[model samples]
Target chain A: MISPSIFVFAPLASAALFTALMVVRSRNVIHAGYWLLPCLLAVAGLFGSLEAHFFVVVQILIYAGAILILILFALMLTRDVMDPKQRQTTKFAPLAVPLCIFVGLGGALMMARAPWPAIQAAAPGPAEQTKALGLGLIGDYALPFEVASLILLAALIGAICLAKAEKEPAAPEPVIDLRGEIELEESVSAGAADGH
Target chain B: MTANLTHYLALSAALFGIGLYGVLARRNAIAVLMGIELMLNAANINFLAFWRFLAPNSVEPQVYVLVVLTVAAAEAAVGLAVVLNVYRSFGTVNLDEIARLKG
Candidate 1:
């Protein structure tokens, strides 16, 4: 019997692959960045079809929402938009194409040939899976979780330091001619008194 | 035929290949970062697929995926910062032009 998920999986996978191709092939960097959005959404859909409920949300939230926005912001900051005239690829593209094909096909072949010990058991319910995930995160994976947080903090600091605009030292305050100002004020006052 | 482990594996492999091509062939630094993001996503898909098929009851794969995601986020942040800095100093983010180390 064909699983219902195949319907979802097929379209999502095709979308992912197609958009991924577009991401690499697009001459305009902004267009490529836009193409990445659908590709990421398709990947999230794939996660959903796989029944990874938590991951579907995470994938969409982090990969699609946060990461894609970050990438677009970087693209804008770098002013890499609208360069259709420039060659997007390097001179080594011909060599890279064949090498990538070999690597991809070789990986697929290996995965197909490998004997996977796939269990026949159904996946746990989403609620139970989420609960277990929470427990495992704070239990067995606590150390790694803490480490990941540390890495994030460090990255935040490093990014700020690296991207920050260098500030020129403050120029010395302009020397004010106090005497001229006072003399001008006195003359104005004297003229007023004379008028009075 | 329904989608299975082999199908997911094949898809990920294709994604990985595309990402690899992007990394190697793209002249722009930001594009290379995009390629890296694609590659990381490919790895995440593989991890989740294996977790679902091989050990659905275990949370190991999920935890690993979380770690990978965290690292990916960090990498992107730091990498984009480096790229921004490069653009500031060099006035171009083209990898070929910024190859000062190439003797």
Candidate 2:
């Protein structure tokens, strides 16, 4: 039977599914970016259900607010945000059915007996949790954080290099014909040169 | 009236399944990124679910989820930055066509 929580999570789940499909199947990349908003918000609701109030707020702010907007900007930065032409990649038909069955069964059964653990050893309150996180980041996991930053730096440099590399090749933009529809394929990458 | 772990699990499962569909079916790189984000969010829900239903007191998962949040932010920033370059070079966002390094 459905509970009141169903009233909330149900719509959230449906929104997530709808937006996800839109994001995948949408012809326009920029349009897909806009559709991501609802999917991220649904995930935020899931976070709320998990009792991570902080995560819910943060997901909204960072994922839905910042990241989605960034993606939209990136899509817009390219010239072709609204080409109604449908492009073709390999038909994504055969794989969808088996994948759905596998993921559905795997996710459900895998989570069925998932050891939902809660530490009763020490009752760390929310305030203490923040304190612990700060300590862990600075004291123990500082290296990993720094490492991630370095990787990001590398990606930044790589993006820059890629943008600069092919100033010479000078090939016109590659246009893809999906189902006989021409779609312009340009990299929104800021760093196309270095990696190239 | 309170949602339980099963509720979170079902939600997460659905999310995961959707993500799998996206990763498999979508050809655009950015759309694939969206799929990955969905998958991560599903896992995050699982973390918070365990924390709530199983623990209900400690905030370690909460902290960890925040860390994951930061990581996801970093990833999107960097990944999109790279994708921009990928698009510029290849002129196509289809993952299959970007196989220049396939040598």
Candidate 3:
């Protein structure tokens, strides 16, 4: 399988570990979003090691390239991206500490009991992978696949409506309040002069 | 280095656990989405590993991973959209403030 040596795996593993931690701990939401890039790249490298070459490309293109960038852009669009009051990373450390240890034990248990796949007669070459997958999706899986796509489209339409609805309601209230405040201040001064 | 089932299983388990921690601990909706992605990825590793080792010569595992990848992409799209809605509704992406299940 022409795999790289342990040196490559170990560092990549450590980097992934560090980045995942940083992903949760970075208070600046944008910085935390950026951490996903290294974390994802390391995983994509792992996919390459596993001989899932196509997955590696999709991982880089879809996840690191697209999703993470969108997340950062969203963070920037929000006014309070990392305001001090909303400290994302300030004291979340203690709550999850023991939970992490328990999770490590559970992972160990899962490793011991993992079901290995039964033998296959022949491995599909990577070149044939896309073709085979496309055939499966449209063949036996077509009905379910199409239904799921319809559901997704419905959801997309719903989201657009909700985002649009919010903007129209918020615009008029501020202008109405500004005019009321100016009139109210003028009324209070005129009343004071009449009393004097 | 002979690749064995145990090595792959260990990798999958570790990655899944990291993902689990991320899901439970991360406050940012995007980070939680990333955690979910990691968990799906851990499953993919196991799928490909099984195809490589046990089913030494089958197209099924390759196809299985492809389906999984597609599903994960769809899931991420839906998940990100939901996170955006949540941000618009609450003005913050922190999940702790939005404990209610209903809209």
What's the lDDT for all of these models?
0.88, 0.68, 0.67
Docking class of predicted structure 2: acceptable
Candidate 2 at A186: error in angstroms?
54
Indicate the DockQ of the complex predicted as candidate 1. Answer: 0.69
> Candidate 2: what lDDT?
0.68
Q: List the residue pairs that clash in candidate 1.
A: none
Model 1, A1-196: lDDT tens digits are 1232667788998999999999999998889999999999999888887788999899889988988899999999887533779888889999999999998888988888887755456788799999999999899989988999999999999999998987757999999999999999999999999999
User: Per-residue lDDT tens digits of candidate 3, residues A8-43?
Assistant: 566666676678767766666677778878988987
Separately for all candidates shown, the number of backbone clashes (residues 3 or more apart, or on different chains) is: 0, 19, 5
Residue-wise C-alpha lDDT for candidate 2, range A41-78, written one tens digit per residue: 87787666444556677889989998888677766655
The deviation in Å at residue A10 for candidate 2 is: 3.0
TM-score (second chain) of model 3:
0.92
TM, every model: 0.89, 0.72, 0.73
Answer with 1 or 2, whichever has the higher lDDT.
Answer: 1
Please report the candidate that would top lDDT against the real structure: 1
DockQ for all models: 0.69, 0.33, 0.30
Least well predicted 10-residue stretch by lDDT in candidate 3 chain B: B1-10
